[model samples]
Target: MTTLDLDFVRSHFSAFNEPSLAGWSFFENAGGSYACNQVIDRLTNYYRKTKLQPFHPFPASEQAGREMDAAINNLAAYLNVDEDEIDLGPSTSQNTYVLAQAFLSIMQAGDEVIVTNQDHEANSGAWRRLTDRGIIVREWRVDPETGYLDIAKLDKLLNDKTRLVTFPHCSNIMAHVNPVAEISAKAHAVGAKVVVDGVSYAGHGFPDVDALGADVYLFSLYKTYGPHQGLMVVRKDTREALGSQGHFFNEGLVHKRLVPAGPDHAQVAASSGVTEYFDAVHAHHFGPQADASKRGPDIHDLFQAHEQVLMAPLLEYIRSRNDVRLLGPENPEERAPTISMITNRDGRSVAEDLSKHGIMAAGGHFYSHRLFQGLNLDPEAGALRVSFVHYTSPADIQKLLKAMDAVL
Candidate 1:
């Protein structure tokens, strides 16, 4: 098995080399990650030289269109989905809002839609609003003590009337990686379509959308070391089931149907850089002979192995503290690198104190207010979140532990 080359991985991201951010360690990666040099360079070149309307006869326009198309096709290959299924929107929140609207037009008044307490507002709020149109919205609540969504409970939620089921691949606050395939299977048994929010999970590694068995899968590129854009994959059958949200004339185009806000040409084109970065990492560690589809799991395993090692000490420390309540699983294999804790101290104040030691972290509800309320946590003060990615070093984790000791 090939391990991820940390030296080779760190070299792709420009943030590691910045003078101002030199000594300071970043742990707020769940909010957003530093962009890789490949993405930045592509974005700069697109704005400087190819700042023209795409798909035109001119040189700049043709090149711009090619880059954008390549991004969709390349990413689709990595995720093992069709190119037509990929939709790039402004943000994940915006994407779900549009999807909900499409569902609204097609769904009947008695139709049931299920939402979870564990999802970010991006996936929850939109579907919940369908209640206004006489749709029956059911809540798939989480365990207050552990913040885990019990799969057994979902069996009761799904019925003949259930039209859709939306949940997260992993919660931002809880950090427990949900079993998408298992949940999707249960939903499918009841003839319900599944929508998975992968925004929290994608940074670990892009999951195979086909394998996950979700009708609609979403993730944010900004959190995945690219530009601020949301990438959505809607299965062809599901897309055809929903009403088109785009213009009447453009209704025939499946890709443009849901994203009526229109595409950002430069950012979409720059997304190709994300694929390029993954390829570079794969080629450096393993051989360059593997196809894009084959490389996805290899790169995914490499990052997952490295992240689990980093998560163990942090989990052990948090779980041992009498004053703190650690959210999600203690085992690193069962979760991502996002660790949140409820402490006797104020979340904001603890974050401020950590900053003095040059550690970057955050404290807030993270837009999962329903989750906090369900767990009997105060939404006003929220919980302290320390998140990181494969780029984070062991030295950084040591610094975080030391800073946390001083604050607590």
Candidate 2:
């Protein structure tokens, strides 16, 4: 695979050149990423030219509809799934909540579903509520020391009665990249479907959703250099068995089945910019491909290769520190670049100290309070998070280390 061109990648994000954002290294990417220039330009263009309702015969309306369709198709191509299998909702929280209702529709009083402490609340909360409906909600917990969900533990949790299994592709706090394909295979053998939450993982690079073999996949577009939209991919085969949460009139449409609320028009239309941006990066590094779908794995490798390099020095620095405790896998290769540490002070105060040195980071439970509880830590205090993605440069990492020396 071709190496990632950092300067070229940085050029695609306007935030790097923004006056107020200058001199600051961003480490809060797990919260949300800076939208690339393509997404931004598409957003502004939509607002300026096609502010009208879409799919009508009038020019602006027709153009608006075209953009929206293109967005879905292009994004689907990159995800390696059918166009109708994709749903773009308001956010991951909303998408998962409505989806749980669909799951509930197909479930019985004593049906069993599995959940995890290692997942963000968006992925865990709505499903947990099924307990009120008489569904057996079993907890597949993380290893407190590693903050990772063990596949062996999942094996123990799985049996003939297992209906569904929901877990994160990577933990936001620990950053351990779960073996999704392996987990999916185990779940399938027990006649269960797996909902893989790719929110914390997708931003680093878009995985081959089809290859992961998940029955359903979810991720946040806002964190993937696109608009504030949540993407849910319900495979053609799996969605056939699930119930719809959409309007009775729209039950025929697969994409509309899970999204109960109306989508944001401009945001949906502008989302094509994400694929456009990815195409540019691919062309820059590995030249052109006839299909964007084919580029998913290669692009994933390119981005992850770059990110792993960025992770090396920081992991080394954290290893040398006696005062700092790094959560998740110690090896950068085993996890995402989202590093969280617990120190003497509370996470918030330490984040405040780091901010004084122009390092952009935050400290909080980050909606993984259950994971903290599993680890015997105070959710209110939380851990300081310093995360980065492919766009993060060596200079930015160095800047962070220099500030770490001062603050820690």
The stretch of ten residues in a row with the least summed lDDT in candidate 2 is: 254-263
- Candidate 1 lDDT over residue span 1-408, tens digit each: 676678889999888899989889999999999999999999999999998889999898999999999999989999999999999999999999999999887689999999999889989999999999999999999998889999989998889999999999999999899999999999999999999999999999989899999999999999999999999999999999889999999999877899998899999999989989999988888877467888988878988899998998998888778998888899999999999888887677789989999999989899999999999989878999999999898889999999999989
- Tens-digit lDDT track for model 2 on 342-378? 9988998999999999999999999999999999999
- Error at 35, model 2, angstroms: 0.2
- Candidate 2 regions exceeding 4 Å error are none
Number of clashes recorded per candidate: 0, 0
**Candidate 1, 134: how far from true, in Å?**
1.2
Off by over 4 Å in 1: none
Give residue 190's error in model 2 in angstroms.
0.9
